[model samples]
Target: MADAELYAALGQLKLSYRECIVLQKIEGYSIKETAEILTCTEVQVRNHTERGMKALQKLLGGEIDEIG
Candidate 1:
C-alpha cells in the first residue's frame, strides 16, 4: 500500500499520540524491554499492540496477521 494508506490505517487504530510513539519508536525492544520502558506490564503492551493492530486492519480493510 502507499504510505498515505498505511498512515491512514494507523490513524484508524484510535491510538493516542503517545501510544503510537511508543510502538513505533520502541519497536526494537523485546516484550520485557517494552514493558520496562513504558512502565507497564507485558500484558498491557501486548493488549495495546493487539488492539492497535486490529484497528489498523479495519482501516486497511484487510486482516493483518502481523504489525511488523
Candidate 2:
C-alpha cells in the first residue's frame, strides 16, 4: 500500500493496537521486546498485533489469513 494509505489504515486502529503494530511490526521489534517497551504482557502484545492486522487488512481491502 501507499505510505499515506497505510498510515491512514493504522490510524483507524485503537491506540494500543496501533502502538503494538508500530513497535513490533514497523520497528521490527521482537514480541518480547515489544511487550517490554509497551509495558504490557506478551499476551497483550500478541492480541493487539492480531487485531490490528485484521483491522488494517479490512481497512485496506485486503485478504489476510491468520497463518500470515
Candidate 3:
C-alpha cells in the first residue's frame, strides 16, 4: 500500500496514544528504548506492540505478511 493509505489506516485504528507510540517507535528502537520513551515498563511496551499490531492487522484485512 501507499504511505498515505497506510497512515490513514493507522489513524483509523482508534488505538490508544501509547499503542501508536509503541508501534511507530518500535520500528527502529528496542523494547527497552520504547518503554523508556513512554515512561512505562518493557512489558507494557510489548503489550502495546502486540495489541496495536493485532488491531492494525485486522484493519488491514488480516494480511500478516503485508504488515510485517
Candidate 4:
C-alpha cells in the first residue's frame, strides 16, 4: 500500500508500538539502535516491532511481514 495508508495503520497502534515501527522500519534503525533511541531494551524493541508489524499488517490487509 501507500505510505499514507501504512502511516494510518501505524497510527492505530499504541504510542510505543508506533514509535518502534517508525524508528525501526521508517527510519531504518536496527533493533539495537531503536532500543537505544527509545531508551528501552533491545528485547523490548524487538517485541514492540514484532507486535506492531503484526497489527500494521492486519490493519493494512496483511501487507507487512518484515518485523515478524
Top-scoring candidate (lDDT): 2
The lDDT per prediction is 0.62, 0.84, 0.63, 0.83
TM-score of each: 0.66, 0.88, 0.72, 0.86
1 versus 3: better lDDT goes to: 3
Per-residue lDDT of candidate 3, residues 1-68 (tens digit): 66665566678754563354434543667777777766888887777777777776677677645432
- Per candidate, the number of residue pairs that clash is 0, 0, 0, 0
| Candidate 3 TM-score, true structure as reference | 0.72
Q: Write the residue-wise lDDT of candidate 2 on 1-68 in tens digits.
A: 56787888788899999999888778889899999998999999999999988888888888444321
Q: Write the per-residue lDDT of candidate 4 for residues 4-68, one digit (tens) a residue.
A: 77767777899999999888777899999899898999999989988877777788887765542
What's the distance in Å from true for residue 51, model 4?
0.3
lDDT string for model 1 (8-60, tens) is 66655555433743464435567677677678888877777666766676677
What's the C-alpha lDDT at position 62 in model 3? Answer: 78
Instruction: Using TM-score, give the best candidate's number.
Output: 2
Displacement of residue 22 (Cα, Å) in model 3 is 5.8
C-alpha lDDT of residue 24 in model 4: 77
Q: Give Cα distance to truth, residue 26, candidate 2, Å.
A: 0.7
Q: In what order do the candidates fall by lDDT, top score first?
A: 2, 4, 3, 1
- Model 1 whole-model lDDT (C-alpha atoms): 0.62
